[model samples]
Target chain A: MSIEMTKAEVPGVPLLEVRDLHVEFHTRDGAAKAVNGVSYTVDAGETLAVLGESGSGKSVTAQTIMGILDTPPGKVTGGQVLFRGEDLLTMSEQERRRVRGDKIAMIFQDALSALNPVLSVGYQLGELFRVHRGMSRREARAKAVELMDRVRIPAAKERVNDYPHQFSGGMRQRIMIAMALALEPDVIIADEPTTALDVTVQAQVMDLLAELQRDFHMGLILITHDLGVVADVADKIAVMYAGRIVENAPVHELYKRPAHPYTRGLLDSIPRLDHKGKELYAIKGLPPSLTAIPSGCAFNPRCTQARDVCRSEIPPLLDVTEPDGTPIGGRTSACHFWKETIHG
Target chain B: MGRYVVRRLLQMIPVFIGATFIVFMMMYALPGDPVRALWGERAPDEAQMAALKADLGLDDPILLQYWHYLTGLLQGDFGTQISSRREVIDVIGDALPATIRLTVLAFTITVVVGIGLGLIAGLRAGGKTDGLILFVTLLLISVPVFVIGYLYQTYLGVKWDLIKPTVQDSEDWGQLLLPALVLASLSLAYVARLTRTSIVENRRADYMRTAKAKGLSARRAVTVHLLRNSLIPVVTFLGVDLGNLATGAIVTEGIFNIHGIGNTVFHALNSREGSTVVGIVTFIILVYLVVTLIVDLLYAVLDPRIRYA
Candidate 1:
C-alpha cells in the first residue's frame, strides 16, 4: 500500500493549525471540560511552546491532534486539526493513522517507559520504516543505525542491538527522538520530553531536539510545564491555566511583558541567582478543577487584578495593544485588563 | 546458558529426592498394608507370612530398605509391581507414550484456543464479544472438570457418536479427541482468563501507546507489542501446571478407558501397589521439573532484560 505524503506545501498556509478545539472527559465523577476553545498555529520552521502545569489540557490537545485520545474518558467534542490543509480530525481512522508518525509524530516524557523494553532499540526504530515504507529488514536496520547516528548516539552501530533498558536515561530519550525522526514527519509534538532527565541531560536533549527541528525545518510543538526549558527554543508561547490559553505571544515579548497575571506569576516563579536569598515567588492558588471551572475568566480566583467584570463575564482572547493603542500581531490574552497587565 | 541449564538440572536432584521420599513415607504410613491387601480374604499361616516378608526384604530395617530403594532407583530399577509382578519401569514405559500423546494434544488445544479467545476478548474489551468470552470462560472455570468430561462423553460420545467411547489401542488417536477436549476445558478457561487480564493490562502500557504513535495499526500493535509480553505470564502458569495436566490425563483416561500411565497409577493406588504409584509419581515430578526449566529458559527468550548469568 502506498503511503500518503503530506499535502504539497503552500507558502502562506501554516504547517499545522488547531481551531476551536474542545475536549471533555466523561469520567465517573463528572464530565470534565479538559480543553475549551483552544486555538494555535505553527509555521513550517517554528517552535510553539504550550506552557502549562499538569492537568491544564496541553497534552490533551496534543493527543486530540494526533487522534490518540482514549475515547471513553476523552472525547474531542469539537475541533479541527489541520495538517497541510487537510483536517486530520475529519479523516478516516486508516487515513488518520497514515498521517500519524508519517506526517505528525509525538515523543513522550518518560523515555524508559515509552520505548518497548523487550525489543531492541534498532528493531523499534526500524519498525516505522518497515511498516510505513515497506523496507526490507536489512534496509530498516541500516536506516535505524543511520537515524541513531543522526541523533548523535555514540557507537550507533554497536548499540543497535541493545534493548531500551541497556541505555542511560538521556540516551534513551535520544533514541525516542530518533524514532520520531525516522520517517521525517512534518510536525513533532514533544510532551515534557526532558521532565524525567537530569538538569544537564535535559539541556542536551532539548538542544538536540532544537537542532534537529532546525535541520528538518519541521513544526515543533513543545508541551512543557517548565517555563525555563522553552525560553531559548520557543518562537511563540501559549500559557494555559484551567484548560484555557490565558496568554499567547512571541517568546521574547512574553518574557518581557506578560499580558496575563498567570503568565506574570509563572515568569516570577522561576528561580534566579540575583534573587538567591528570598523564597521563590509562587502562584497563589491551584488551578480550577476542569469539572468545575470558574464561571468567567478561569484565572480570576487567583488573579491579583481580578475585578467584578473578571468574575461576571468570560474574557475572550483579545488582541494585545500598545500603550498608544497599536495592536501587536499574533499576540492575544484572555484577560480584561491585559493592557494594564502588559504595561504594569 | 549451558551453565544455567546444568545448574537447574543439579537443583532438580534434591527436589526429586525430597518428592520421592514424601511419596514413599505417605505410602508407608497408609492404613492398609500391601501384604494384607494382597492376601485379601485369604489368611496366611504364620510361617507362610514370615517367608513372604523375607522374600520381599520387608524384614530389613527401614533405613536399609530405603537404601535398597535408593540404590535400585539410581540403577534405573523402579522395583516390581506387587500385583502384576512386572518391573515398575516396564509398566510405566508401556503407558507413558499414551499419556504423553493425550496430554500434549489437550495442552496444545488449550493454548491455541485459550490465547485466541483471550486476544479477541482483550482487543474488544468492554464490548459484547469480550463480555461473552469472559462469561463463558468464567462458567467453564466454575464447573468441575469431571462434570464437563462426563457431559461431553454423554452428549458427544454416547449420544451423537462424534468420538469413539473407548480406544481400541494406543494408536486409536481419534478416540482421544472428546476426552482431550474435556481435559483441556478447565486449563483453557484458566489460560484464557489469565491471557485476557495480561493483555488488558499490557494494552494500557506506555509502550503500546508508543507503538500506536509509531503508526502501527491497532491489530499490529496488539499482536506484535502486547501479545508477546502477555504470553510471558501465561507460559509460566502453563509450565507450573504441566504436572497437573499430566495427572489430569489419569481421570480423562479412566473415564475413556485409555490405558495410559495415569490409568495404570489409578489402578495401582486402588490396589495399594506402593511401588508402581511411587514410580509414576516420581516420573510426573521429573516432567514438572523439566517443564519449569524450559519455562525459565523461555523467560530469557521472551524478555531481553532477563539474561543467563
Candidate 2:
C-alpha cells in the first residue's frame, strides 16, 4: 500500500534519520544482536512513535540514539544514526556527548529511579542551565523554577528544593520532562516515558510532550509499547518486531489500516474502552531470543498469517499500495499476507 | 542525634568489658610469667618471687585481677609498670599524641590522595591510568607492612633523602614519615581500589545517565553524582579498618624509631611491664571506638539512606 501522506513534506531537512542500524552485545554465552538493521527518519517538528513490545529493541535503540548504551554489554555494530546530517555512529565520544544534551536529549522511563534521590528537583533541573549555558546558581535556580512552572508542577518555586523522593511518580516524570526541556535541544527521545506512571499522569505527560514539541518544533521520538499513546501524538509510527523495523507509515494511515502483521497484532491487542468486556486479543508466543534469532522472519513463528515463504526467506519491506497507489513513509511493510489483515 | 550519642555511649559498656576480659585472658595465658621475666633467667628464691607476685596481686584469682584492672581503669589510676615504675596512664598519654599525629596525617593523606586518584581513574575506567592505579594498589596491598616500612626507610628515607633520617631513639618527623607512609600504604591502596570500584559503579548508575541527560559535564557527573554516593561504602571500609590500622601500626612504630603506643607496648612486653601493656591496649580500644563512632556519623551524612537508629 504505497499511500504516502501528502503531509510528508517536512520543512527544510529531516532532523534525524536512522539507516540500517545494528547493535550487538558480547556476553559470556555469546553475541546478542539487540537491534538489527532498523531504519527510520524524523523530520523537524515531527513525532515518530517507535511502537514495539517489550524486548523488541525499542529501549536499546533509544539508548543507542541517545549515546548512552552500556559499552561492555552494548556495541553499535553497524549503523548510521544521522542527527541533522551528522553521522552519530561515526562521531567521537566527546563529539557525541556534546550533541547528547545540547542538540539531542533523552527522557528515561521510571522517573522515580531516574532522578538522583539525594538531589533536590531544583538542583537536577538547574544542572542543565548551569552546565551547557554556564548560568549562575541564582539564575539557574530561577530558571529551574520557571521550568517547573512550565511543566505545571504545583508550588514550583516552593517545591523546587524538594528531593526526588519527595515528589510523586507523576511529578517526578514531569520533572524529568522539565529537565529534558531545560536545554531546549533540537531532538528529544523519550523512551517509555510514561510506563511507570498512572494512566492519568501518562496522558498529562504525553500531552505536555505534544505541547512542548509543538512549541519547540523539535523532532520528538516517542518509544512506547502503548498504542493509545501513539494514536494521539505520533505523526508517524514505526512498528518494530524482533529488533527490526517491520513497518513504517503515518499514524492516521497505519491506525486506519495497519500494513504489517505485527502492527495489526499490536492494534488488536489493545483493550479498547469502546469494546469493554470483550475478549482481549493478544499476540501469541514470546519475543525471539536475540542470541539465537529465527532462520527467516523473526516474527514468522508468532505471526498468524505467516506463510511457508515467511518461514524460509525474510520478506523485505515492499511498498504496499492502495488502488490509487500513493507512497507512505516512502515504505510500508515486510509481510507476504499484509493485505489480508489490512483489507480484512 | 543526642539520643543516638547517649545510646551509643551506653552500648559501649558491655563491649569495653568484653574487650577488657579478652585482653586480660590473653595476657595471662601467654607462655611466660611476668614475675619470672622481671626476676631474670636465674630462678629467684621464694622470698623475691613471692614479693613480686604479691606486688602484682598474683595471689588473686583471674576474675579478681580483671575486676581490679577495670576499676583502676575507671578511676584513671592504671598502675605503674612493674619494671620501669612509669605509670601506665602517663606512658600511654605521652605516646597517644604521637600515634594520633601519625595516624591522622596518614589518614588525611590517604583520603585526599587515594580518593582523588581513584576518582580520576574511575571517571576514565578501563583506561591506562585506571589500569596503572589498579596495578599499583594491588602491589601495595600484596606487600607486607614491615617490608614497605623498612623499604621506605632504606630508600626514600636514607638513600634518596626524600625525607631525612633520625637516630633510632629520636622522636622526630624524619623517622615518623617512613612509619606513617608504611602504615598508610595498604589502606591508601585499598581505599583507592574501593573508591574506584564504587565510583565506577555509581558512574554507571541510572541516575548518572539522568545527570548527563540534564547536560551535566562529565566532571560534574562523576564528582557531584558519583563520588558522594560511592563514598558511602568507603566510609564503612574506613570504619572497619580503624581496628586493623591500630594493630598494624605496632609493626610500623617498631620498624621506625617513633616512640608511639605501639613501641611502648612492645617495650612493656619485653620488660614484663603488664600495666603499660594493658594501658596501651585500652588506649587502642578507645581510639578504635571513637573512630568507628565518627565513621558511623559520617555514614549518616554521606548516604542519606542511612539513619542513626
Candidate 3:
C-alpha cells in the first residue's frame, strides 16, 4: 500500500502521458516514419489498448514510452513521454534506467526470446529484487517463489529452479508476467502479451493480466491488433494507421459506432459465426509504407470513403458527435468524412 | 559425470592403440635399413650384423616385432633407441618439461590477448578499434606459422638482439618467451575472430535486450548475459588449440632450437631412429588424447544444455 502512495503525489497528472510523439527509423532507403505525432494518456488502474496492424507503430509507441527504443536505427525525432509529469526523454540515461523495471516495467510478446534461456526462472525473477531493492540472494529467491506462486504457477518451489526451455508456452508467459510484476512497477506496457499463446491459453493469460492490473492498480497500455481481445480489457481504444492514431474513443462507444472509416473496416473484417459461408470482408488496399504514406491522410489509399478533399488536405483529429450533434466525450477521429462514417 | 568420464577414458584406448600402431608401421616402412643406417657408410661383419638384428628383434616378422613392442609398452618399457642405444622412456621424459613450459606460456598469451581484443572489438563493433583488430588478426592468420616463427627469430632475435637468437635453455622462461609468442600468434588470431563474431551475434539477441530492460547496467548485461553465451565456441576452439600447441609446433621448435617434443621427433626422424621416433610419437599421441578428453569434459561445464550421460 505504501508503494502505491508515491504515484498519487500529483492528483491531476496521469500515471503516464505521451504527447505528439514522433519516431523514425533510418533505413538505407530513407528515414521511415515509424511513429508520427502519436499521443495518449493512461491513468492508474486504466487499460488503454493501442490497436493497429503489425507496422502501424503501436509497439513503437509503447517501446518509446518505456525508454527502451533501439537508438541507432530507431530514434525519437520529437515529442515527450511523461511519467507523473516528468518527461522521460529529457532525463539522463542513468535516471531513465532507474525508472525502467522499477517505475515502468514492460512485458514483451515472445516469452521464449524475452527470457534468458540459460538462467533459471528463480534467478531471473529474483534479479529485480537484487538490482532495484538491494535484497540479499536468499531474500530475492524467497520473493521469487512468492511471485511465482502469485502468478499461480503450480508448485513454485519445485519449478523455480527450471530453465526457460523447461516450461510450456503458457507457463513461460506466466513467468514473464511474474517478472514484470516482480518489482511492483507503477505502469506496465504489455506488447501483444497473448499473441503467441494457444487459443485457450490466451484467455487465461489475459484474465491473469487483468486480475493483476486490478490487484496492483497499475496503468497498462495494451498494444495489439486483436479487436476481440481489446473489446474485453480496454477501457479506451486508439486505432492507429501508418504511425498515426486515426481514432480514439471509449471502448463501448467506439464499437457501438465507429467514427473513422478505417475503424469501421477493422470491425467489419472480424470473422463471425453468422457469416460462416460468405466470402470474408477485407479492407481495400494494404496500409501505406511509412516512407511513402499519402499526403493528406495515411489511410486515404485504403479508405473506401476517401474523397478529393482527403487526398489534398490533412485532417486534424476532431471530436466525434452523433448525427444530432451530441458529442461523445473523448471520441476523436482523424478523418475528412467522420460525420459520414458515423452516420453510415 | 563420473561414469561418463570413465566411459570417455575407456574410449581413448582404441584411439591410442590405432594411433601408435600406425606410427609403428610407418617407422618400419621408411626406405632405409635401420641397422645399416646405424653403422653409417662402413660395412659391419655379416655375423655381427645378424647377431645385432636378432638382439634388436629386427630379424623377426613385422607383426612379431609390433607384438614385442606392444608387450614391452604395456610393461612400462619404451625400448632402447637403435641409433643412440639410449632408453626411449628416459629421452621422452627429458624432452617433456621443456615442451610443457613453452606450450603453457603460449596458451596463456593466446587466451589473454585474444579474448581481450575480441571483447573490445565486439563491444565497439563498426568503430575504429574494431576495424584495427580485424585488420591485425587477418594479417596474422594469412601468414604461415613457419614464416611467422622465422620473422620473429630474425628481427626480434638476431637483428634487434632483444632476446637470444635461439633458446639457450628451454627451462629459462624468458628465453622461451619469443618462441612461445610465435607459437601462440596464429591461434591467438583465430580465437580473437571467433570471440568477436560470437560477441557481435549474441549482442543482438533478444535476451540481451531483456537484460537491459531489466534495469541492468550495460556492463552487467554484457558480462553476465552476453559473454557467457558468446565464449562457448571460443572455448572449444581454445581446447583444440591447446592440444595442437604442445605437440604440433614442430616448425617453431626447429626455428627456436628448443629441445622439446618437436625437436626430439625431428632429430629422431632425420637419424632414422625408428624405435626413438615411435616411442616419442606414441607419448605425443597420449598427450593429445588426454587434452582433448579434458576439452570434452569442459564443454559440459561451460554450457548447461550439454549434459553428459
Candidate 4:
C-alpha cells in the first residue's frame, strides 16, 4: 500500500489536533510546567507516536488531549485541543464526557491494575456498550465476548465471566484494548501501552494495535519511550524533551537522519542487534525539571554541539535542509549546527 | 470461597474460648456477691447465700466453675438468671431481638447519613461542603451519646412533639427516627471521618486515573473505581462500631427507655444477677466475633486481592 505524507493526504480532517498546549501544576513551591507549548496532529488512520523519556511530558500531553487532568493541582493553562473542529479544552464537562469514551478513547499502562478488581471482566468490558451504546445486559455481554475475541483473548466466551485478577498482565492489557475499541472511537491514545509487559508480549500488543488500527481506520497516538516499538508502529514521530517537542518528522526520515541533538542521542543510546555485544551508548544526565527549565535549548546542557550561543538563546524548531539544501516537510532543530549534525 | 468460609469458622473456636475465659475471670473479680446484690439492702443470711452459691456451682473451685460454664455453653444452656429464676438464654433471647433491631436501625442510619456526607465532603475537600461536614461531625462527636440522646428526647420527644414520648410508646416512623438518630450520631461522626479520609486517599490511587483514561464518566470513576476501593477500611470501622452498638448502647437505651440488651445488662448489674451478666457479656463477645467475620468476608469480596491466608 502506498503511504502518503501530510494532513492533506488524509480523506477527512485530522481526527485530533492539539496546538500550543501548555499544562501546568500549581504546587506549594510554584507552578510546574508539565507540557510546554506542545503541538501535534493525528489524521484519520494515521499513527503518530509521541516518543519521549519519562518525565518528558508525553503522558501529560495525552491527558490534556483527553481532558482528564486533575483540576486544582493540574491545570491546562493554555492552548486548544481541536477534536472534529470542536475545542475540547473549552467544552463543558458533560460534553467532554460524552465525547470521551464515545469519540476518543485512551488505553492506559498497567491494564491489570486499571480494571476493577471486584467487577467481572465481562461486566467491566461490557460497561461501555451498556452505558454509551445503551445495550441490554445480555447484548452487552455478547459484545464483550466479541471484543475479547477481537483482542485475541483465549476462550473469550468462557473467560468473559472471570474477574480482573484472574487474567494475566498481557491478557488484561488486551482486555483494556478491547474496552478502548468498544466504541470504535475516532482516535485511540495508547499511553505507554506496552511498557509494563515482557518484550515478547509488548511486540504482540503493539502488533495487535496496528492490526486493529488498520481495521478501524482510526487515528492512533502511541506514546512511549521505546523507539523499537515506535519504529514498528508509528508512521510519524514527535521527539520531546523537557516538556517540549524538539523534533517532528516522519518515522523513516527521523530514523535515517535525526536532526535534533536529543533525538540523535536517543537513537544512538539504543542497543541494536546490528551492533551485537558492544557497549550501548546512553544519553548522559537526567531530563531537566520543568519547574526550572534551562535557558537556551532545553537539551543544550547535555547537547555535545552546545556553543556559548546555545547556552543563552532558546532554540526554536526550525527547518532541516537536505544535502542539496532542500527543506524537509516537518520542523527540525534550531541548533546552529543542525546542518552539520544532519549532513555529517 | 466455600473453603475460605470453612477456615474462617474453624478459626473462631480459639477466639470464643479466649473470650469466654476472660468473661468468667472478670465476673469473679468484681466485688460483692450476686446473691447478696440480689438480696439488696435486706442482705441474705450467710447459710442461704451459701446454699444458693452451691446450687449455682459458684461454691465450686474456680476451675470447676469455669468447666461448668464451658459445658453449659456447649450444651446451649446458660443456666438461670438468679433474680428471675429464668433461663439465662431465655432472658437474653427476649432482649436480643430488640437490641438487634435498635443496632441494625442505628447502624443503617449511621452508614447512610455518614457516608453520604463524607462522600460529598471528600469530593469537595477544601470547599465549604468539607468545612460544614467537619464542623457537624466534630460537634456531634464532642457531645456524649447520652447528651445527644437526652437532647433528642427533650426537643424531639418531649418539647416540639416531632416524635413520640418514648421509643417504647411510639410505633410511627417519627418515633423510630429520633431513637435511630440519637443512637447513630456517635458512630456517624466516626464513619464520616473514616469515609472522608478513605475516599480522599483513594482518589490518589493510580487506578482512578486509569478509569478516567478509559473515558469513563466522572461519576463512574468516583463511584465504581474509587468508592469501592475506599470502602474496605470504612467497613472495618463500621464492623467494630456495630459490635459496640450491639453490646454498649446502655446509656442510649436508658435515655430512650428502650428494652434492649443494654438495658438488660443494666438491670442485671443492679439486681446482681450473675447468670444474666455472664450471659450478656458472652453474647456480646459472640456478636463481636460474628460481625468481625462478616466484615472480613465482605472485604475479601469487595477487594479480590484479599485472601483468608
RMSD, candidate 2, Å: 4.9
Ranking by TM-score: 1, 3, 4, 2
Task: Please give, for residues B33-80, the per-residue lDDT of candidate 1 as tens digits.
Answer: 676666788885778777877888877876677778878999998999
DockQ sort, best first = 1, 3, 4, 2
DockQ of each: 0.82, 0.44, 0.69, 0.59
Q: Is candidate 3 or candidate 4 better by TM-score?
A: 3
Q: Candidate 1: misplaced stretches above 4 Å?
A: A1-6
In Å, residue B143's CA in model 2 sits off its true spot by 4.3
Q: Pick the candidate with the highest TM-score.
A: 1
Worst 10 residues of 2 chain A by lDDT: A1-10
Candidate 2 ranges beyond 4 A from true positions = A1-10, A20-22, A26-32, A43-45, A72-79, A85-95, A215-217, A272-280, A311-313, A324-331, B31-38, B41-64, B116-143, B147-174
Q: Given candidate 2, what's the lDDT at residue B137?
A: 91
Error of 4 at B23 (Å): 1.6
Per-candidate local distance difference test: 0.89, 0.82, 0.89, 0.84
lDDT of 4 by residue, A86-196 (tens): 688887777677778778898989887777777788988888887788899999999999999999999999999998889888999999899889988889999999999
Per-residue alpha-carbon lDDT of candidate 3 for residues B234-261, written as tens digits (9 for 90 to 100): 9889988987886656888998889888
**TM-scores of all candidate predictions against the true structure:** 0.97, 0.87, 0.96, 0.92
Identify the CAPRI category of the predicted complex in candidate 4. Answer: medium
Better of 1 and 4 by DockQ: 1
Report the C-alpha displacement of residue A84, candidate 4, in angstroms. Answer: 3.1
Steric clash pairs (candidate 4): none
**Candidate 2 DockQ score?**
0.44
